[model samples]
Target: MSISFAFLLKHIRPFGTSGYDTFCSVDLANFLIGNLGLTLGDIRVLYTAWRGVALSDAQSAAIIDCAKDVANARWGQLQQTTGSTVMFLSGIQLQDLSNASLGQSFTWRPASKIAVAVRIDGGHGGHHARWDVEGFSGNTDSQGAICHFSDLV
Candidate 1:
C-alpha cells in the first residue's frame, strides 16, 4: 500500500524546527499526490548541504547554482512522469533566518515556486530548510508557486 502524504509528513517532522517548513513540504507533497494523483512510492526526497565550503562569492554562486540545477532536474523528471513535482531542502542551513532569501533568488519555470525558512537552535544544532513545487500546465509548462509553512512542522 502507498503511504499517505500526511503520514510521510508526520514521519519527517522531527527533522525540522519550524512549522512553516514542515507545512510547505507536506502541502506540496499533498498537492503532488492529490492533484497529480501520483503514488507516494513514486516520490523521492533528496537532502543536500554545503557546510565545509569556503565563504566566498564564487563558492556561494557555485553552491546556489548547483542547488538550483538539482531542484530543476528533480522537478523536470517528475513533470515527465506525473506532470508535477515537489522538492524539500533540509539541513544545517536552516538555522539562520536569512537563509530564506536564497529561495527568492532561485529560479522556477512556468509558475514553479519555492518555500523556505530557517530553523534556529538556541542551544541545539541548527539547519536550513526549504520546499519547492513545480506543476506542469497542459502544454507541459510549469504552473503556480506556493510556499507553505508545513515544510518544517
Candidate 2:
C-alpha cells in the first residue's frame, strides 16, 4: 500500500510543541518510502521512529542535516531493518497564512487549508500549526489539516 502526502495530511495530527522532527520524520519517512523503495516493514520501522526522541537544540539544523545525510549510508540505522530518516527544509520558506483557519484548541478539521506555525523561538513551526492541534488529545483525526500548496515542497 502507498501512503500519499494527501493521506498523511488528512490523517495525522500535529505533535504538541510544534517540533520540526515530528513533522519532518513523518514526511521524511513517507518521502523515503517513495524515493528509496523501502519495504512495508521498513516503513513501519520508520514511522515508529517518529516522535521517539528529541533531536532539537540551537544547532538542530546541523543535527537534522547530519541525520538526513548519514541515514542514507546504510539501511539499518534504527534497528535490524529500520533505517533512520531525517527531514530538512527544502529552502522554500514562505510565511503565507492566506489559507489557514484552524482554531486554538481543537482537533477537528476545517474546510480551509492548513498552515504550520513556527515559533519565533524554541521548537519549530510550519504553516500556522499552533492552533491546529495544540489542545488535541487524539492521536489521529478522521480528517486533518490540509498541507498548503506552498508547503508542498
Candidate 3:
C-alpha cells in the first residue's frame, strides 16, 4: 500500500487529467499543500524545472513524480530507525515477482550494507584536502540495502 500518483490525484477536487493544461506547478502545489503540508516553493521549483519541456499532461505527471520521490525518501529514512514491512513490486534476489501473471505473489527479504571512506586532495598541494567517512557506527555493513528491479514489460 504505497502512496501513488492516482491516489494523490484523488485528493484534489477538480484535478483530473483535463486540469493539467490550465494548472501550473503553483496550482498543483497549492492543491497538495492542504493535504501534504509541503513547502509550495519547493514543489514549485520541481514543477518549474520541468515546465515547457513537454506537453501539459507530462508536466503534471512530473510534479507528481517529484512529490512521490520526496515522500519515498522520507519513508526510507523512517525505515532506518524502525524497520518497515515493505512490498516489493518487482523482485529481490532469489525471488522473482516480475513475471507474476495475476494472482501470483513472492516474498523476498534481503539485507546488506557496506562502509566507505573517501579522500580528495588538491593537485596543487596537500594544503587542500577533504575526507568523507560513512557507516562508522552500528552495523555499518547493513546500514542500507536497496531492492534491485527493472521493468522488462
Give the best candidate by lDDT. Answer: 2
TM-score of each: 0.24, 0.25, 0.25
Candidate 3 Cα RMSD (Å): 15.6
* Residue 111 displacement (Å), model 2: 25
Clashing pairs in 2: 115-127, 115-128, 116-126, 116-127, 116-128, 117-125, 117-126, 117-128, 117-129, 118-125
56-151 in candidate 3: lDDT tens per residue?
Answer: 332243334433443345454443212111111111211221122112122222231111111111132121111121111111012122222111
**Residues 52-99, model 2: lDDT tens digits:** 322333233433433433333433333222223222221121111213
Candidate 2 TM-score, true structure as reference: 0.25
Each prediction's Cα RMSD?
14.9, 13.6, 15.6
lDDT of 1 at 2: 22
Alpha-carbon deviation at 33 in model 1, angstroms: 1.3
Task: Give candidate 2 misplaced runs (Cα > 4 Å).
Answer: 1-17, 20-31, 50-55, 59-153
- Candidate 1 global lDDT: 0.31
Q: Across residues 10-87, which tens digit of lDDT does each residue of candidate 1 receive?
A: 122212334224334555556767876766664443221222111223223433333344344444444322211222
The lDDT, on a scale of 0 to 1, for candidate 2 is: 0.33
